[model samples]
Target: MPHSHYAPRQHASARADAPRQHQPARPDAPRQHTSARADAPRQHQPARPDAPRMSSTTSSIPFVSASMDLSQDPSSPYYVHPSDNPASALVSPVLNGENYNHWSIGMKRSLISKQKLALIDGSILMPPKTDPTYKAWERANNMVISWITRSVSPSIAQSIVWMDKTYEIWEELEERLSQGNLYRIAELHQCIFNFRQGELDISNYFTQLKILWDELDNFRPLPKCTCEAMPDTKKYFMEDRVIAFLRGLNDTYAGIRSQIMILEPLPSLRKVFSLVIQQERQTFGNETDMKVMAINGPWRGRGSSVNRGR
Candidate 1:
C-alpha cells in the first residue's frame, strides 16, 4: 500500500510572524465619501417621481439581476450558494470513529461541491490583511469550520472544535480514527478467505465481496510505477481477489469456476465477475425450466393415456 503524505497546516502564530511584501498607498487614491455636516440628524429622501410604487410582495425585497454571476465576484469564493446552505450541507453521514473512511470520503465530496476543499486540505494559502482576497479567504475558512462543526456528532465535534484551522481539525480526526488500519486489513483478509455465499443471491453475494475488495484496495493501494513488472503485480493481486470471490460462490457455480481456472490465460476480475453473473442467470434459468416441465408433466401423462385408450 502506498501511504499518503499529508503535511499538517502551519499554525496561525507561524503565519503571523512571516514577512510580507506591503504595497505603499498611492497619493492619487480615491477619497472616502463623507457627509457635509457630520453632526446633522439623518433624514429620509423622497422617492424619484418616475419610481414605481412598491407592492406588499415587492417592498424591501432585494432583486438580483439575471446577468449577475456570483462566480465572477472577487468575494464569490466565500459566498455560499442557496443550494449549499451550511445547515443543509451538514446532512452528510456522521462520523462515529468506526466509519471514518466512508464518512471522510463523503464529507470531502460535499466540501468539494461547495468549493471549500482547500480549507480541509490546506491547498489555499491565507492572504494578508492588505491583500484584496483576504476577506474572501477568511470567509471561506470560517464557513468550512462551521460546516465541519455542524456535520459531526456532538461528541466528535466537541473534541475537534478547539482546533482553529480546518486542516488541523481534519488531521486530528484522521490521527484519532485511522489507528486500526492494519488490523482492519487483516480482519478483511480473514473474512474474504472464510467467505461462503450460501443461499444469498449472486448479485448480493458479489456486492458484499466487492465492498471488502474496495476497502482492502483503499487500505493497500496498488503500486503506481508502470514498469513492465507492474502488470505482473496487478495480475497477482487481482488473481488473489478473483480466487477469493470464486471460493465464496455457491456450489452451483463449481463447473463455471473450474472452467475458468483451466483456461490458459486467466480472465480479468471484471470478466470473471461477468462470467459468474452469467452463470447465476443460467442457474436461475434452469430452475425456471425445471418448474415449467414439472407443471406440464401431468398434462403430458394424461394425453399419453388417452392415446393408448384410442
Candidate 2:
C-alpha cells in the first residue's frame, strides 16, 4: 500500500474554457443582393401637388428656372443661342419704335442743310472789290479815253488848217474874176482847185470836208473862215464849182501836200468823225445831202446850144 501514492488533480474554470459565439443575422437590414428599387431615385422625383408640373410632350420649351439660373450663375459654362440673346433682340425694337437711326440721319441732314443755306445766303461771301482785276479794268478805260482824246485833237486841228488855206486861195480867184481878168482868173482858179484837190487826197479831203461842215453848223463868226465860202447871197452859175475849185490845184506845192499828210497823226479820225456827224445831226437837220455833194463831184455844167435852127 505504501507504494501506491497518487498526485492531486485541479478542476478547469468555465469562463476561460468557453468559445466566442457569432452575431444573429438581422432581418430588417439591407442585403447585398437587394433590388435597386430599395434605394432613392437620383434622376427624377414626384412633383408636389402645389408645384408646377412640366409637360412631358413639351420638351422643346426651355424652363424659366434654367434660364434664370444660367444668368445668376457665372460659373456655369452656358450660353443661349445668338438668336435668343437679349441685347440683339432689343436692337430692332428700339430702332423701329424710337426711330433712332432715322433721327440720327435726320440730324446730320439738318446740319448739312444749314451749312448749304448759309452758303447760298452769302453770309460768308467775299467780293473782289479790292482785287487787282478791278483796278486793271478801271485803268484800261482811262487809257482808252486818253488815246481817243489825243487822236481827235490832231485831226481836227489839221482839218481847220486845210479849210483856211482853201478859203484864201478861193478869195484870190474871186478878186481876179471880179476884175474881168478871165485868163488870170481861170488860170488862178484852175491852179488853186488842183492844189485843193491834192490837199484833199493827202488829208482824206472828204472826211475833213464832213468835219468842216460839222464845225460850220455851230459857227460863231471867227476871225476868218479857214475854208472860204462866197457870201450866201452871191449866186454862181457854175454847177461844178466845188470840183472846179479842186481841179485847178497841183500836189507839188508844199502847203497843199503838207496839210493833207497831217491827218496821219490822227489814229481815231474815223471815231471822231462819227461822233461829230452824230452831234451835227442832233444840232441841225441831217446834212447828208451836203455831205453827198462834197463827196460826189459838183453838179454838171449845162452845155451851150448850137445855132442850127436857121
Candidate 3:
C-alpha cells in the first residue's frame, strides 16, 4: 500500500491536459439577438393594399361648415336660403321705424258682418191722442189757438177753420174706425193738435209719432172707384193722412224742418205706394175674376142656372 501511494501521482502534462473547455457567451450579444427575433415578424409582413386611408387635411374640416353649406343649397332637405324668407323684404330701412298694425283675415270678415242701423218706417212718426206726448202737443196747440184767438189775424182764422174741419173728420174716422186707414187720421189729429200747442212734451210724442209715421208709410194713392155711384151711399175716403200731416208739420214748424226734410227722398215711401197700388189692383182683379166665374158657371157647367149672387 506504501508503494502504491507513492506511485499514484500522474504526469503534470497529463494532468494539465483536460478536455478543451468552451468560453462563456457575452450578455450583450444574447440581449441583441433576442431583440432582433422579436422585430423579425413585423419586418416580413406587407402593408394591406385595400384598407381605407384618411388624410389629415380632409379630416380637419369643421362639421358645422358642411351643415351650413347643405342648408344654403335649394335642393337640400334642410335648405333655408335668405331669398326664400318672406320677412326679409319687410325689414327694409324705410320700413324699420314705421309702426304697422295689421288685421287677420278672420278679424276683417267679422267686422264687415255686423249690422250698423235699423230700418225705420215712416208711419211710426205719428202717435195717437192717448199718448202722453199727444196730450202735451194738444196743450201746446191750445196755447197757439188761444194766441190766434187773441190776435184774430186772417191767416190765423183760416188755420183755426182748417183745424176745426180736420178735427171733425178725425173724430168721425176714430169713432167709426173699421180698417188700418183710420190709424193715419188719428196720428194726424195728434200731430196737428201738438203743432197748435208749442209747449207739448216731445218725448213720448216722438215715440208715438214714429209708430204712426211708420204705419202711414205703408199707404199708397187712391185707386179709381170702379163701382157705379149708388145714390145716398157714403163714400170711402182713401187719402193718406200721415203724408198730409208731415206736409203740415213742414209748413208750420221751422224747428222741425230737418225731420220733415228726411222724408223728401221718400224711396221707401214710393216703394210702399207702388206695392199698395199693385195689391189693391190685384184684389179688384180677383173680385172681377170671381164675378166672371159666377156668370160663366151656368153656361159652362150642366147645372140648374141659379144666379150666384156676389
Identify the leading candidate in terms of TM-score: 1
Give a tens-digit lDDT track for model 1, residues 234-260.
888888888888888777788999999
- 15-101 per-residue lDDT for model 2 (tens digits): 333422222233223453253444444223454422444454354355444335432242322222233322221112222212333
Ten-residue region with minimum lDDT total, candidate 2? 86-95
Candidates in order: C-alpha RMSD to true structure: 29.9, 44.2, 35.2
lDDT of 3 by residue, 1-310 (tens): 8776655555444555543221234566777898898778666543332222334445556544543543344543223334332222212121111111111122223222311001011112223866534443343233323322333334333544555222332233233333444555576556644642122222222345555454444443344455666321222221233344334332224434344346543333344334433443453555434444444455554343333221
**How far off is residue 36 in model 1, in Å?**
58
C-alpha lDDT (0 to 100) for residue 153 of candidate 3:
31
Name the better of 1 and 2 by lDDT.
Answer: 1
lDDT against the true structure, each candidate:
0.71, 0.33, 0.36
In model 3, where do residues sit more than 4 Å from their true spots?
1-197, 218-310
- Give the better candidate number (1 or 2) by TM-score: 1
RMSD of 2: 44.2
